[model samples]
Target: MSTNRQLVSVDYEIFGNVQGVCFRMYTEDHGKKLGVVGWVMNTREGSVKGQVQGPADKVDEMKQWLRTTGSPSSRIDRAEFSNQRDVPDLELRGFSTRYH
Candidate 1:
């Protein structure tokens, strides 16, 4: 039988008018629906930061959704993605708004 390995982590910095909108909530909803495990939050720099761990294909799908149709009221200026192998486990029970 084949072993099921945990997928690598993907860190993304989504810029543009991601703040003041329901970007985080949308992202969380979409991510969870896509079977991704992570948390999304607004940074102090008016950007949204999120890390998703799942199969590579699913992660790519999540990224695309975030860039295109996730935030209807926001414009996605930039989306930077990177592979992270050492990210700690996260307990993303629900979507939350963080003030920093």
Candidate 2:
């Protein structure tokens, strides 16, 4: 379906108080709800890294949620968004949390 409305993908890295806060679970749930596909995992540097692909609007909304209201207990200091690009189709089937 190569419609005029192209989907977008963004890579983000979250910092601060994310590790023991169920951030990945919450992110998965949110991504599923938003119909975005990508993978999220905890980095060795104590940060959350993932890529989200979906409708441009929804992706933007997800970014907002990730940066502002991540899991109930997460205190997100900042969300760095990068590699934003347009995609012809969804490369992911569903959102999932990756263990790393």
Which candidate number has the best lDDT?
Answer: 2
Q: Could you give candidate 1's per-residue lDDT for residues 14-34 as a string of tens digits?
A: 989888778888888888788
| Model 2, total clashes | 0
Q: Give the TM-score of candidate 1.
A: 0.78
TM-score of each: 0.78, 0.93
* Each prediction's whole-model lDDT (CA): 0.74, 0.91
Worst window of 10 by summed lDDT in candidate 1: 86-95
Reference-based TM-score, model 2? 0.93
Cα error, candidate 1, residue 26 (Å): 0.2
